[model samples]
Target: MPARFMQMQEVADELSVSVSQVYHMVRSGELPAIKVGGRGQWRIERARLEDYIERKYTETADWVRENPLIGREDEIDPSD
Candidate 1:
């Protein structure tokens, strides 16, 4: 079974972003994470990560709706 919680580095790898970027997200409250251990390491729950991804998709959809690109839908296929 996969881990229920992931380390900061693991979250970064999963998102294909830098570890520092992940830290920024956590610090900024864009991504949910909690510090564990006496060493103060950050851990993210898998469910929260999934929620963040879903929220991003929703945000992108809203942006696309609000800011439609001109001629995007009518663009001809260059391959044709």
Candidate 2:
């Protein structure tokens, strides 16, 4: 079956975030979406979104492989 897609507004509303947040999600590639036609409407596939969420969760599973608190030893801590 063909994948069903949702607009940026729909995604934002479903996620309970702002439209800008949805845009940022697309920009960051955290949310799998596509721009359709020349108008460039941000449309996300339900399967793609689910896949993205799964991929993210799986990717983060390695963080605690050593120490959960240890994040980017070279980068400055944001809380500091």
Candidate 3:
């Protein structure tokens, strides 16, 4: 059985990102989370995390569609 909710560190580990990044997402409203317990620790629902991942995939697909690299690959600067 899986947990219904996950701590900030767990979410970060699942997403392969830093814990601070998860905090920023929650703070900026990019990722939905809830504060619980006396210490006010943040917890993200498993469903919500899955939704965020799906949304990101959609957003990335849209961005790729809008910015096709077909003939403009040379325009990108590798040094940057």
lDDT of 1 by residue, 1-80 (tens): 89999999999999999999999999999999999999998999999999999999999999989998787867757774
Arrange candidates by TM-score, highest first: which order? 3, 1, 2
Query: Which candidate number has the best lDDT?
Result: 3
Tens-place lDDT per residue, model 2, 1-80, is: 75499888877887778999989989997787888999887899988877876786877786656555565677757785
Candidate 2, residue 37: the lDDT equals 93
lDDT of 3 by residue, 1-80 (tens): 89999999999999989999999999999999999999999999999999999999999999989988998887999985
Runs off by more than 4 Å, candidate 1 = 72-80
Find the 10 residues in a row with the least total lDDT in model 2: 63-72
TM-score versus the correct structure, for each prediction: 0.86, 0.60, 0.88
lDDT (0 to 1) per candidate: 0.94, 0.80, 0.96
Among these predicted structures, which one has the highest TM-score?
3
lDDT, candidate 3, at 58: 100
Arrange candidates, best lDDT first. Answer: 3, 1, 2
Each candidate structure's count of clashing pairs: 0, 0, 0
Q: Determine the backbone clash count of candidate 3.
A: 0
Clashing pairs in 2: none
